[model samples]
Target: MAGFLELIDNTLGTHFHTPVYDPQTGRKKILRVIELASKQHNEGTTRAPNRSWAAGNNEGISFSPKIDGKPVLIGGKETNFVHKSRFQDFLKGLKAAVEKGDLDKEIKAALDGDAAPRASTSSSSGTRSGRNPLSNVRSSIGRSLGNGKSLEEAEATARANPKFDAAHIDQVVAEAKANAK
Candidate 1:
């Protein structure tokens, strides 16, 4: 049985690990999915920042493990493999490292650098002047009509302005028409 297991080990690598769970919440330290992928067409500087490689019966497979969509960089470079047969062994080693918290610092840095929440579109206050742009359009149109400019002139000025987009123009025009009546 030992020899049989060794033969299997030679064919495919091994990683013996169980993830650590928090005592209070029953949550794994790494909440995201763990994935290993093969590299493909990484054509650019550093050749595709997110490339990985694995092949069937093909040597020189690359391995970059991702946790929550972030690659765990080692020495500032992705991990690759020349002996393709060692794929399973490498995978097991990666899992063991995760279990041992050997990659926590690297993982934390990756997550921190990303700033996931701020990158999301749900934030209404960024890039633009801290206020909803539509409100600015509303005020502009109101001021134009208030300043003795005829509706036609005000509408023409709004349409001619390049700073506003078509949708905003349309919205403000509709509101102006409504308020004029």
Candidate 2:
């Protein structure tokens, strides 16, 4: 349940509606909200985004289901990713159990959580530090080109210097030429 709920929590943001041509009539313009996931609902359009199901991580684990700040264990191991159809079957089992009040004792125990507080985890990726590596390389290449050196001369000079990577020099040189164009 935590996996399902966290999927919703991670995808929230504000967005502006983009006007697209109505495919049905092809005459009227309608506001369309492009979705990467269960994200911002702009004005009126509501639709589910198309996605594919796959594994949880590189460790080859199955479904990782957590409830009430704890991991669910299956056969003395934390549940890992499984195929979607299999997971749906497991959900059906859960539904049946809930209908018969089979998990009442376990649910009560879970609600009465541990006395110790859990430390929250945080991630620091997926965002830029506002610095671009392109600016540095482009500036140096531009200065070399401005010094009246030929392409071959620049290539040879870079090859002699251990600081410049051989494989990337060609790309940077090509980009420098493209910028000139």
Count of steric clashes across candidates, in order: 5, 5
- Model 1 lDDT-worst window of ten: 24-33
Which ranges in model 1 have alpha carbons more than 4 Å from their true place? Answer: 1-52, 56-58, 114-181
Looking at candidate 2, the ten consecutive residues that score lowest on lDDT are 25-34
lDDT of 1 by residue, 1-181 (tens): 5677555554233434634433222113232223323213222122444435434355556555444555556456545454655655665566567667776666665554441223234333222334466765666677788778987787777777665556876888887788769
Give candidate 1's error at residue 49 in angstroms. 17
RMSD to true structure for each model, in Å: 19.9, 20.8
- Give the top-scoring candidate (TM-score): 1
The top-ranked prediction according to lDDT is 1
lDDT of each: 0.53, 0.41
* Model 1, CA-based lDDT: 0.53
lDDT of 2: 0.41
Model 1 TM-score (2 dp): 0.34
